[model samples]
Target: MLARDESDLKRTPLHALHLARGGKMVPFAGYEMPVQYPAGVLKEHLHTRSHAGLFDVSHMGQIALRPKSGKVSDAALALERLVPQDILGVAPGRQRYAQFTNADGGILDDLMVANFGDHLFLVVNAACKAEDEAHLRKHLSDACDIDSLADRALIALQGPKAESALAKICADAPSMKFMDAGPRRVAGFDCFVSRSGYTGEDGFEISVPAEHAEALVTQLLDNPDVLPIGLGARDSLRLEAGLCLYGHDIDTTTTPVEAALEWSVQKSRRKGGARTGGFPGAEKILDQFERGAPRRRVGLKAQGRAPVREGAALFADADTGEAIGKVTSGGFGPSLNAPVAMGYLPTALSGIGTTVFAEVRGQRLPLAVAATPFVPNTYKR
Candidate 1:
């Protein structure tokens, strides 16, 4: 979600492999990453939509929180103190999306929390890794032991055929449903595979030792259905999927309620539940839940050829306009062959059929508030 200079960026284990494939590299989240390959973002995006696409997402932070007493509920309870989610309800081998919130109900970072039976597994934004780890250590030290898996590299295989391609190399991959994750051996290499990905498509994210990352990816690439995808396509894919990128869509200044992620906060943690209001910012969040957020993040489908970029202000019309909100992320949906964007709007203007306008190049483009996942999710559930 962040771009930077390439001079001193950290490299993932598969960075050289990306270079070999003619990747156009750039700096992102403190790492030297491939923004696109020779196939280009458009083709790469379309290819992933058709076949299988492999991506190196090792820049994400992977950590395991183990309780000293080996109590899963203790770790879940400890986690509950920091965020408003039903962590204690996580079943073994299942994962849920969670956001670390602040005292004022602002989001610190959104993450995936997996219940691994004996411990809790977390994957957070790479740019916020150090701070996230520190937050974990500072708060959960008495309840759990947090260990950052710095030696591991994460990669994802996504698309309609991702499962079949993965099954060719790993027997267990085909059996996973959405949100299922556990340790597995693929082509004799030890790894933890999850039936989840950032793309709207059904896929898997594999975490393996840094030393074995290349070998695993190499074998997967050898499959006829799999092609290497880059960050550019990855971003567009998630945007089309209606998934929120940490820094761009949801940030420390935004709360879950304002972000329209109430579905993520389980009902057990909401008001009237037996164990409610224990987490940070619970009062503010629950209050917002009842009274409704002042603003909401809504999907906009621009009805023309021009693509709207992020940060563009929204207006009622070209003349005598009032600033309503700003786009957080926008781009041409390769699959839809049209411009799509997401932004905040007042509650009164957030209905799916509502009409709005985005200011682009001194012109006003009409946009309709369509239901998101601009592309439907093909998740295997």
Candidate 2:
């Protein structure tokens, strides 16, 4: 269900509404999503930077896990055994960022895990949800029940003005803080709202029943600051925020250590030696922690206007042309107003001021390994 030949793309619950709003529909992760609305990608990007923008992320997978004994703590512990993140510490109405790993220590997918009252709520990548569910079912005990929220729709309202705009729609909005989750009525529909987002901004992700999604989105859009955004802008925004995409930036080939995501590995998971080593490739991951990884992901800034897309060859030295790594993601950053990218390179060549070359259109362009988040993120703490 990847974005390949799009002869048959899956439509989301708001597909018709997107078309009505003049969204340029495109195939992404098997879903026919709007890449931009009538406002255009650039406008939508800037608007989201300064105002609130509504995004239809229903294509993402939403799932719930419950303990058969009605003990939520036990369910979280069972999940902690699978992933490196400290799920057991997640408070009710709070969310934690986590990843699913393979036996080789490679990341299968990075996801959000929320303690939604008596049940655990998860929002996983649409492309990897099926595999994630299978893994959870295989690893979890029989007392845990896994349920997919396929009939649910998810939307993100992000940017500086997101809170103020969304507050007008839900009376209980102000009480929620970063990474918090709570149930509330949105547009007359019972919904789960989370104060976390991928765009590196203060935002909320609202999950509602599929049948009531369109109306909920329409009601939010009624506010002047809330505009409909699409996948194109979302990609640029996340990249600018120094976030990684699932298959490209982090994948089965790259471990969390090499991906520069050691922060996501909780401190408790790193303690007790082998006790925290049950996950995939635990030995290798532990070794990398003791000694740094060989290659590491870093941010790249090209010197020219020509943006180097993914797959651009990265070199160890400018004239050597010897491949050190490859660009995982690259594009024009609307916020930074320049070409920005992220990729991996040998540890020696990954320093902040290290110079490299990116092969773009048969010519090597000057590139420097620079600090990420080309633009500062305005996340609410």
Candidate 3:
């Protein structure tokens, strides 16, 4: 849900930095977040593609998982009980994307988990933090200690010059590959830098203590290559990257398989494998693998100028009357120079070249089911 009123909205550690830079603030996920700056969304989106861009994502939930028995694998295994992921298999310093699923095979939230040698670190959506913390404590308390990292702030440096820009401040940052994470001393501040980002670019997500956030952000922004970006550009960049926004692309009523994220669930968690049927909705999820879901998420390219926004109903172009599916996330791809979107359609009409219609403002606009990544992903491996 979007934040609406600033009077009661919470503020992040970087809230002042955004305001100082003339950010147009908006309520988002219970916080006064920056949706855009004076440069505007279009320029901000393009700047991040050409140069490095810094984003303040401190509103997200950061969690630390510690095992009482002092065993890393034990903590990892405990996490596997709630989500349909092979958390125990995550190697030290590596991370994986996972989702907390419901008994009906629906997703509660999606997150990233990193193995930090002695403990596990998780980054979850801002709106789902409380629920996620409760879920972890309810099921994993016996094996591990769960706590929120409320004293930290996170920033992302993204785009083509991300590595070089980061390397200038932190010598070890450039060495990390995709999904790799560990501690590093950057500008004399102890921080956790993960070579991962949301823009489908080669970049890093840095986690630093709250006290050091401002200094770190100031240092990165001084690099000339890095400009401060806001939420509007963040959404557009992620959309072009074809990444899923939790509430829009996935939710409690959507399963991982239905959302086309089966790859994130390793083979070990599937039926006939070790620890099968152990997680929430294991049976339903595995069954969907053999017998696919009736409706599936797919990428859509609008044939007209109007954007097919979320909740817009999809219909068969030829049938004209019966609705087949609905758009979950839709917008104009600044990089693609055209309108791009993602939606769910029945398998019969979900083929890559299938034609469909979006009922936007009473006009049934034509849309085509196309492969995702409306813009090519350039993540460094």
> What is the Cα root-mean-square deviation between model 1 and the actual structure?
1.3
Q: Count the backbone clashes (under 3 Å) in each candidate.
A: 0, 0, 0
Give Cα-based local distance difference scores for all models: 0.92, 0.88, 0.91
Which ranges in model 1 have alpha carbons more than 4 Å from their true place? Answer: 1-5
C-alpha lDDT (0 to 100) for residue 52 of candidate 1: 92
Ranked candidates (TM-score, high to low): 3, 1, 2
Q: How many clashing pairs in candidate 2?
A: 0
Q: How close is candidate 1 to the true structure, as a TM-score?
A: 0.98
Report the error of model 2 at residue 380, Å: 1.5
Q: Candidate 1, 29: how far from true, in Å? A: 0.6
lDDT of 2: 0.88
Those runs of model 2 whose alpha carbons end farther than 4 Å from true positions after fitting are: 1-7, 273-275
Q: Report the alpha-carbon TM-score of model 2 versus the true structure.
A: 0.96
253 in model 1: Cα distance from truth in Å? 1.6
Candidate 2: clashing pairs of residues? none
Please name the candidate that would achieve the greatest lDDT relative to the true structure.
Answer: 1
Write one digit per residue (lDDT tens) for candidate 3, span 1-381: 665556889899998899999999999999999999899899889999999889999999999999989999999888898889999999999999999999999999999999999999999999999999999999999999998999999999999999998898899987789999877888889999898989988899999999999999998889888889999999989988888999999999999988999889898888877877688888899999889998899999998888889999999964457888999999888888899899999987889988899998887889999998888888878
* TM-scores for all predictions: 0.98, 0.96, 0.98
lDDT of 3 at 354: 88
Where does candidate 3 stray beyond 4 Å?
Answer: 2-4
